[model samples]
Target: MKLTETTFQDGTPVDGYGPGFFRIGGQRYEGAVLVLPGQVAAWGGYEDTAPLIAAAGDVDVILVGTGAMMTHLPPAFRSALEQAGIGVEQMASEQACRTYNVLLGEGRRVALALLPA
Candidate 1:
């Protein structure tokens, strides 16, 4: 088997993540984070959908990392995003990170709202 490295020309890809933190661009972020094409910001969990909403026109989808487990987001939250005309996909945080990287590499207009595992 052979391995090929993943590159990020937009800004940075999530370098690593475990337990309660994620690493990107050599910086560590504790708790949740909102990752865009060329930016990453602290996310306030379910309560903080404003940032995502603000980027609705800029992104095609938002991948939500629901910590260590795959769970559903609140109905209101989901509805709000739907109302903004943005797509939402939820899964375990780790998977979300991987998916985000893959989508980003393809140059998709995607965002990641990740909760620490």
Candidate 2:
């Protein structure tokens, strides 16, 4: 049998999450957050599309964490990203964090736009 450590070369993985916060790398972020390769910042939820759109060239897809449960993205929100050539995936906050870490470990270009969970 073989085992290997999950290494995130380009960015940090989600360490933990609960209630209304997420701990990444070793830092705790409150409220909504935008997690991009090698960068993490506060996000203004759905209305804040500039940051996400600006990240289009850096990422292929974005995993959107819609609080504690999965929910459909607003039509305009989805459209804006798609128009910018960025794919969007909607899921619960917990799932999004897990998926983001996995993808990051694989060296895929991905980001996270998360609401509180």
Candidate 3:
């Protein structure tokens, strides 16, 4: 097996994340955050679905980081996004970050909604 340097062609990659914050493109964001191709914004958890809804056309998948543990996303949230035609995958926050970066590096249309660990 061989390893290759990870790179984001046209998307922002998550550089690091901690208890309540995430670093991206040399900037750190606190609280739950939403990451798009080149944009990072605060996320309001399950209550705020508008951002994801609006992003449906731009992203094919959404990586949901459920804090420090892997848990199921609310059915309503999943339904809402599925209804809008966006695929949702839930995992631990840290795992989500790594997956998001890998997909982004491949130039796939993906986004991340992370709850800080």
Candidate 4:
């Protein structure tokens, strides 16, 4: 997918998914099919957000962006996700920030936290 627009999720015109990465409101992301949270994350966000994406379409994995500077995944929850055949990847908010766009570019299905900057 080639995301024609330079900036996504900033209220500017949203372009279809395409190649290259993107910066979402100053946070970098890949050009993958990412699920953006309307707001930041909390304990329930992970469970809440994942199913939303799953409902949207078929996905092999869901990248969970916890929040700024956080990178820990509850073991049981992680295992459950795995058992369901959906791999879960948790990155520091910053890494999530950067990788979201890149993974999108790679055509990966990702879910992002809409944390405030």
Candidate 5:
């Protein structure tokens, strides 16, 4: 599956990562969106970098989830996102993914901000 296009501020098309897709906001991302956990680790470590980078692609809202269990988006990570001009929201990884799915289903352009396990 792929991150399909959805109606949102960005108005850009969403592309999927691979099989077993997870839709957030309105975009579909499969597998792990945090393809390069090491590259931007300092931004806030693994807990913050993943979703921030993934949202860089073509997403309107990047809902960041700091960890596998219910977690919070680190303060530093939020600052980076604010500077990047990407609107961000916070939620758990599981919740973020589920929200992404709903946004996708609703034709909303959103991306999942998650921390890799």
Candidate 6:
């Protein structure tokens, strides 16, 4: 079998993640983070909807990382994004990171709102 490198043509892929931080595109970011195509920013968790909302036009879906365990998003928060026509998927941080990288490598319009794992 031959091995091939995965290349993300549209955005930065998640490189690694740990207890309180994530290494994205070779950059370290602590706390929650929001990663959109070609950009990454410090996120303020679920309550911080402005940045996600602002990205509605740039993304088709957002994968939300709920720390180490999977959890449901707040009703209001989910509602707000849905109202903005943004699709939201909630999963554990580790999974979110992996999924985000896969979708990004496909050149899909996707984003990540991740909590530390």
Name the candidate that leads on lDDT: 2
User: Compared with the true structure, what per-residue lDDT tens digits does model 2 show for residues 1-117?
Assistant: 899999989887899999989998899999999998768999998999999999999999999999999999999999999999999999999999999999999999999999997
Candidate 5 residue lDDT tens string, 17-114: 22334343345554444312122121334454545655565656666654456765567777777677777787655666556656755766565545
- Our tally of clashes for model 1 stands at 0
lDDT (Cα, tens digit) per residue for candidate 3, span 3-112: 98977887789999999999987899999999986688999999889999898889999999999999999999999999999999999999999999889989899999
Residue-by-residue lDDT tens digits, candidate 4, 1-117: 876744343222112222344344445445332444342223244454455344334456556655544668777767766766776777655566556666655555555542322
lDDT of 1 by residue, 9-116 (tens): 754678889999999778899999989767888998898989899998889999999999999899999999999999999999999989988987877888999999
lDDT of 1 at 80: 92
lDDT per model vs. reference: 0.88, 0.94, 0.92, 0.49, 0.51, 0.93
**Angstrom error at residue 79, model 1:** 0.8
For model 5 the TM-score comes to 0.51
Give residue 62's lDDT in candidate 5 (0 to 100): 68
Q: Is candidate 1 or candidate 3 better by TM-score?
A: 3
TM-score of each: 0.92, 0.96, 0.93, 0.51, 0.51, 0.97
> By summed lDDT, which 10 consecutive residues of candidate 3 come out lowest?
4-13
lDDT of 6 at 114: 96
Candidate 1 — worst ten consecutive residues by lDDT sum? 5-14
lDDT score, candidate 4: 0.49
User: If the candidates were sorted by their lDDT against the true structure, best first, what order would they fall in?
Assistant: 2, 6, 3, 1, 5, 4
Of the two candidates 5 and 6, the one with more favorable lDDT, higher being better, is 6
